[model samples]
Target: MTRIKKDFSLPAVFAGFITFLIGISVSSVLVIQAGQVLGANQAQISSWFWALGLSIGLSGLILSWKFKYPVATSWSTAGLALIIATGSGYNLNEAIGAFLICGIMTAVLGFFGIFQRILEFLPQSLTSAMLAGVLLKFGITLFTVMQDQLIYVLVLISTYFVSKKTLPRHSIVITLLACILLTPLFFEYTATKIHYGMTYPVWIQPEFHWSSILGLAIPLLIINMASQYLPGLAMIRSYGYKPHVNQLVSWTGIAQAIFAPFGAFSTNIAAISAAVSLDEQVHQDPAKRYIAGISCGVFYIFMGIFAATLTGLLLSFPREMITTLAAIALFATIGHNISIAFKEDLDRDAALITFLMSASGVQFLGIGSAFWGLVIGFIIYHLMRIQIKKPI
Candidate 1:
C-alpha cells in the first residue's frame, strides 16, 4: 500500500490517459479501415480491437514493470495502412496467415539479435528526421481542424496556451479536461450506450498463400521493424532510456503470433503515442514514470473488454476534435525531433531529405516512406562524406 502511494501520481495517470487518447484517436480508424478492407464482419472487427488491446496492455504493463521505464507498445500503424492499401482479393483467413508469418519473422529476428544489428547502421539524424516527418501530418491536421469547429478548437487552444504559461506541467491535462467538458455542450454527439460485458475473441483458422506471404507478410515485417520499432526505440533513447530492443521486439512478435487468430494484426513498440507518457512533464523523477505505463495498461485492458462500446464512444467525437488533441499532445515531441535531425550541419541536407520524403506520404514498392526515407538519407550522408574526403 505504501509503495503504491509513493509510485502512483495524478500527473502520471493523466499522462497514461493522454497516451491512450492520442494512440486510439490517431490510428484506430486505420485499424477499422483495414478490417473493412479485408471484409471482416462487425464481430470480427470488434475481436480485432479486443485482442490487440489486451496484447498491447499486457505488453506495456509487464515491460514497464520489468524494465522500470515507461515502455509503451501499440499496433503497427504502417502495417495497418498497408492492409488498407492492398488487402483486395484476399480472404480473412489468408490475411490472418500473413499476419502470423509476419509475427513469426519478427520474433525470429528479435530472438537472434538480428533486428538490433540492422538498426545499428542507421544514423541518429535519419531516425530523428523520419520521426519528425511521420508526426508532421498530425500537427498540420490540428490547424486544419480549426476551419470546421472554430469555437471548439479555439477554446481548447486557448486553454492549452493559458495552462502552458501558468501550469506548465499540466498544460495538456488542462486542455484535455476542457475538451471533455466542452465536447458535450458544443458537439451534437449521441453517447454510445455503455455495454457491460466481456468481449469474446473470435478465432479464424489461418490459411497461407504464396501471394499473401510475398505481398503482405514480408512487407508487414519490414514496416514493423523499420517504421515502428526504429522510431519507438529512438523516442525512448531520446529520453535517456536504454531500451532492450531485442526483448521488446521479441515479446511483441510473440504476442502477435499468439493472438493473430483472434485478429491481433501486429503489435509493436509505440513511437508517437509513447512520447505522451515519456515526457518530463509526466513526472519530475524518471524512475517513477512506469506508473504511466501501468495506468495505460489498465486502461487498455478495460477498453478491450468493452471494445464494442468504447469503440463507439471513441468514434462519437468529431474527427477534428481528436485531430486537434493529437496535434497538441505530440507538439513538443515533433519539435524536439526536428531540432535534433537538423542539429549537425554535416547531416542537415540528408536529414532534410529524409524528413521531406517521410512527410510526403509517398509509397514505393508497396513500402512506407519512412523506410525509404532512411535508405535515401543513409546513401546521401555517405556520398557527401566520401566526396568531402576526396582531395581536390
Candidate 2:
C-alpha cells in the first residue's frame, strides 16, 4: 500500500531485525533443550524453528497490518523453560498433545472475551511496574557483563549516548552496528561452523494423556498467559498502544493449535523483543510504528525459511554481547516505564511493591515473578483504597 511505502524506514526495519535476532539468540537454546528433552532428533528440532517462525510471522503480520499497531508475536520462551524444567518424563507425542490442549484453552478464553476482560481491570501503574520488572533483568545483565567485558560494553554504551545525541532516530541502529562490527575485535568469529538451508516441518501424531494434560499443558497455559501475554500487553500499553487483546490471544492460540504437531509448542505476544520495535528509534511518530511490526514479520518468515542456518548465525555471537545490546536498546523504554509506575502519588506504594516483586524473580507453584508482582500490586492498591474509604 502507498501508506506502507511512505511509512517505511531503515531504522524501523533494523528494529524489527533486532527483534528477530533477540528473539532467536536469547532463548533458542531453551527450544532445543525442550525438543531434546521430548526426544526430538535434529530434524524435529529444526521443525520447531520452522513452525515457530511461520506462526509468529503470520500472526504478527496480520495483527500489525490490520490494527495499524506494532503487534509482534513470538514463541513462548517461558513455555520452553517449563518443558525443560519438567524434565523428560513425557515423550514428544505427549508434549505435542499438551501443546494442542494449551492452544485450544487459550483460544476458548479469548473467544469468550474472558482474557480481555481480566486485562481491562489492570491498573496502568501496576502494569507499568510489572513491565519494568520484566525489563530490569536485561539491565542487570548488561551491567553484570560490563564487569567482565568492561571495554566492550563501554564502547557500546559510549556509542549509544553519542549517537543518541547526534542521531536520535538512528542511535540504536548505530549502537547495534558498533556492537556487531566490534565483536570480531573482541571475540572470535565462527562463520565457518554455520550451516545454511531451509528448515522442513516434521509432524508428530498427537496423543492425549491426563498426566501431560495436568502436568504440562495446564502449567504451560498458566505460565504463558501470566508470564508472556500479561507483561506483553503491559509493554504495549506502556508505550501507549491499545492492542486488541482478544484478537491477539485468539489468533496466536489458533496458530499454535494448528502448528502444534510441527513443533510450535506455544506462540504469544513477544514482550521483550517487541520492545525493540516500540522505541522512538524505530519511528518518531507512534502512528507509523506499525512498519516495525511488518518488518519484524518479514524477518520472522525469512528466519523461519532458513531456520537452521539463520538461527546458528545469530547464535554464533556471544550471549553477553547480545544480552548487553538488548539491555541498551531497552534503556529508554525501561526508564519510561519506571517514571510511569511512580508518576501518580496514589499509585507509588503499590507500584513499588509490584516492581520489587517482579524484579525479585520469585516463583510459586511454577508461575513467575511477573504474575506475582501483579497480584501483590493489585492487592495493595485495593487495600490502599479501602483504607482511605474506611469509616474511622
Candidate 3:
C-alpha cells in the first residue's frame, strides 16, 4: 500500500484521465453505431456504455496492479465496425450470444497461447504496416475535417504544436482545452442533463443461433484479434514494453465474456490510448507507470457510473472536432508505425502491400480488410522469397 501510494503522481493521474477521454472520444461513435445496428434501444445503448466502461476499468485496474505495467484496455473498434456492417440481420439478443461465443473463443486462444504463437510467426514489418493501414483513415479524416473548419482546426493545431514544444507532457491536454474553449464560440452549446447517480447494468438474455455464431461470432473474433488485438500488441512492442501477451489476451477475453451479456462486445489491449499511458512523459520511471493505468481504471468507473449523461455529452461534440482530436492523438502513433514498417529491406515491399491493401478498406466475404491485408501480405512475402531462391 505504501509503495503504491508512493508511486502515485498527478502527471500519471492526468495521463490516465486524458487517455480515457481520448479513447472514448475516438470510438464512442462507432460503438453507438454498432449498438444501433444490433437493434439496441436507448436504454440498451446506455447499458452498452456502462458494461464497456466497467469491464475496461476493472480489467485495467487488476491487470496493471498485478503486472506493474500500464495495461490499458479498450473495446475492439474493428469488432464494432464489423458488428455495425454485418450485424443487420441479427437482433440484439442474438448479437449478445455471438459476443459471448467470441469471448469464449478468445479466452481459449489465450489459454492455449495461440495468440502469442501467431504473433511470433508474424514479422514486425507486417504488423507495423497493418497498424499504419488501420490508422490511416483517421489521418485522412483529420485533414478533410480541416478543410471545412479551417480556423478551428488551425487553432487546435497551433495549440497542439505550441504545447508540444513547451509543455511537452501536456500537449494533448492543452489542445483538448483549446477545443473545449473554442467549441462553444463556433458551435451552440447544449447542456445534457445527466442523472447524477449510479447506473445499473442492463442484462439481456442471450439467444444463440448457429447462424449467428458462424456469421457474427466468428467474424467478430477474427477481426478483433487481427485488427485490434494484434496491432495493440504490436503497439506495446513498439514502445519497448514486454507485456505478458498470453496473460493480457486471457484476461481481456475473460472480461469480454463477463460483460458480453450486458452488451459489451469485446475488450482488448488498447493501441492508441496505451501509447499515451506508456509514454515516458507519463512517468520517467517506467516501473511506476502502472499508476496511469490505475488512474484510468478509476476514471472509467466514474464514466460508467454516469454512462448516459457522459455518452450524451460526448456525442454532442461536433463531428469535425471529434475527428480532429482523434487524428491529432493518433498522428504520432501513425508516423511511428509507418517508419518501422519500412525500416527493414527484406520486408519493405511486403509491408507496403499490406499498408495499401488495408488502407483500401476492401472487404472480402464477411471479414474486414485488416485480416485480408495480413493474409495477402504474408502470401506475397513468402511468394517473393520463393521466387528469389528459384533458378533464373
Clashing pairs in 1: none
Worst 10 residues of 2 by lDDT: 188-197
Residues 89-185, candidate 1, lDDT per residue (tens digit)?
A: 6889999999999889888988999978887787888888989998899898887888877888888888888888888778878888888898778
- Estimate candidate 1's alpha-carbon lDDT, on a 0 to 1 scale: 0.85
Q: What is the lDDT of candidate 3?
A: 0.82
Best candidate, lDDT: 2
Q: In model 1, which regions exceed 4 Å deviation? A: 1-4, 387-392
Candidates' TM-scores? 0.93, 0.97, 0.90
The number of clashing residue pairs in model 1 is 0
Off by over 4 Å in 2: 388-392
CA lDDT scores, all candidates in order: 0.85, 0.89, 0.82
Q: How far is candidate 3 from the true structure (C-alpha RMSD, Å)?
A: 2.6
Which pairs of residues clash in candidate 2, taking residues 3 or more apart in a chain or in different chains? none
